[model samples]
Target: MPFDFPLIATIAAVFLLAGFVKGVIGLGLPTISVGLLSLVMAPAQAAALLIVPSVITNLQQMRPTATLLPLARRLWSMMLGVILGTLAAGGLIAGANAAGAAAALGAALVLYAAIGLIQVRFQVAPRHEAWAAPVVGGLTGMVTAATGVFVLPAVPYLQAIGLEKDALVQALGLSFLVSTLALALTLSGAGVFTWASVLTLVPALAGQVVGQWLRTRIDAVTFRRWFFAGLLALGAFLALRWLLA
Candidate 1:
């Protein structure tokens, strides 16, 4: 199903913006893309279009073959929970439920940005990973199944673990990479992802390239301050859409 010219253009523009944000911050491809595209398409369809690009960016983050092994070892149980949880929710994640998920995603975004703006730190104690990882990963997977957004508790949990900043980022990358892969599998099983949606990847990837180039020239810390601010606005819009509906 080739999209109309206008729809194609909109998809391109959405990804261009989303990719730039991701390059600056190392996340938000799914959040930004799904949030914006939901305005014009079904949440599931919007999610479908994100499949290829999300995986590509996460792969970039989780690079150096050696980097993945330790994280994967540490994260495997949580990652397993993510995959299983998504599969379990497969039946309920469409139609009206998808809208509800969007609303929930919106609310979470608003809260997430608020937390980021305040520069507060939350920690997960080392002994708790056994219990916490599965719980957090399960919740994250359920949200991904429903909303195509998966940051929430997982990010804060990862951030708080007292890993060096680099390791934390790597953990985020790995988490997102697995989430994307799990989402792709879940969406494939649901039979909602189509060839046309996959085609959207070309433009999205192109936008990411431009975003990566721009990222090097900018101050990431300063940009992130503004980024969270913009995220607040975006979240409000999404919340309003749900309210208006």
Candidate 2:
């Protein structure tokens, strides 16, 4: 846990890149950061370091609070399911050996990338949402607890339920915020949360600022394609490397 010069540099670089991705798409901070950091450290440790940055950055995404309450009310079942599922599976990653944790993280990244690349669209009828939301939420929470990434079924489910663009962004923020808080609690209970996690905030925040600035100049759609492609490669590398090791 000692932040030596090399380790500090690695953390700074990883967060900078991850933050940039999130700035452009309003997601990927935790996903990218945890995936990259797991290359050098245990997944549990990488996840611990991500807590502060993920919570803060996601909070920023939940802007224009005027519509927040209605979104929350609509998604409350899913949020509750996230909390329960996370709590139930809290020990999975922390209790795992380094190889197992790394492999799981890698697999999660690969799945996420595949989903993004496929760009599959699903429509959920309004009547079904009452039963569907919690199921998606619970699955997402279990995934979050295991891999420190929470965008799989949750993101797709949200998209399927039909929110406008702005509302979709805000909904993502809210869902992430809940997932993050729940993860933080579980990590803490597992004794994986470290005071050193706070040290990551400066570089992470700085990177997000730069990314947000660049977002205005770039074509996000093109960037997204490249991003998912890179993610797929990285995820494959990590999974293969550790599983074979």
Candidate 3:
């Protein structure tokens, strides 16, 4: 179905909001955007619309962080796992029904929010993490491509390793960028990208800028508390809507 004008405006507004939240919290752009957009569009279309903008916007988010080559080298194995996982789960995403897909995604967000509430911190040895990396990365990659879900069983492992904030942000950004690029290329081969998808970028970019600006003024802890709460709220709202519908 073609997008009506009102739908376009609503998506633009949601992206702008999602971006602001990401800027403040170091993540959430995709989660928030995907959650909100699925309300108005097919899950496949929502995922496609985000592919170009997420790559561009995440690059901007990653620009502020300094290089941590040593750390990056350590994480390469995890990245590899993410790639394999994406390839494994990528096909299932496009086939999911919109409401069912959204509900699944919403449940994941709720789980992430609950984990965030625990404020858990840990210290794991590299060897242990090395073993764990593939499992987490692969799951992260698959959900990211399909439903924009990037929480527990994926991101938490990165956080647990005591990765520095800047490096962590870049790592997350790079993961999404790589996976999305792969997804985009695959979809393009399958004739998925189109003018309407291209049209969604303008508002998405606008939101990214706004989100970055919001990032600076907020205290990190406060920002995270509210951010996760929003995720929980978004998930709850979606669940209720689905039940009602």
The numbered model that scores best in TM-score is: 2
Candidate 1: Cα lDDT at 71: 74
lDDT for residue 167 in candidate 2, whole number 0-100:
95
Candidate 1 per-residue lDDT over residues 1-245, each given as its tens digit: 45389988898888888887777677878888888887777778888888888887777777766766887888888888887877777634464576676676678778878988998798888899898888888888887887888787778888887877677778888888888888888888788776665666677677778778888898888888887887788778878888898
Clashing residue pairs for model 1: none
Which residue pairs in candidate 3 have backbone atoms (N, alpha carbon, C) closer than 3 angstroms, thus clashing?
Answer: 16-207, 19-211, 20-211
Candidate 2 Cα errors over 4 Å, as ranges: none
| RMSD in Å for all candidates | 1.9, 1.2, 2.6
Better of 2 and 3 by lDDT: 2
Regions more than 4 Å wrong, model 3: 1-3, 64-68, 189-191, 240-245
Model 3 agreement with the true structure over 1-245: per-residue lDDT tens digits: 46477887787787777766766666776787778787777666667777767777767755653484665677777778777776676655566466766777778788888788777665677779867877778777777656655554656787777778778787777666666676676456545555465556677777666667766666878878887887889887777777788
Q: Assess candidate 1 and give its lDDT.
A: 0.79
Q: Estimate each model's TM-score.
A: 0.91, 0.96, 0.86
How many clashes in each structure? Answer: 0, 0, 3
lDDT of 2 by residue, 1-245 (tens): 65389988998899988888888888888888988898888888898998888888888899957899999999999999999999998967788576777787788778878888888889999999999999999999999888888887899899999899999999999999999999999999999987677777777888888888999899988898888888888888888997688
Highest lDDT model number:
2
| Candidate models: Cα lDDT each | 0.79, 0.87, 0.70
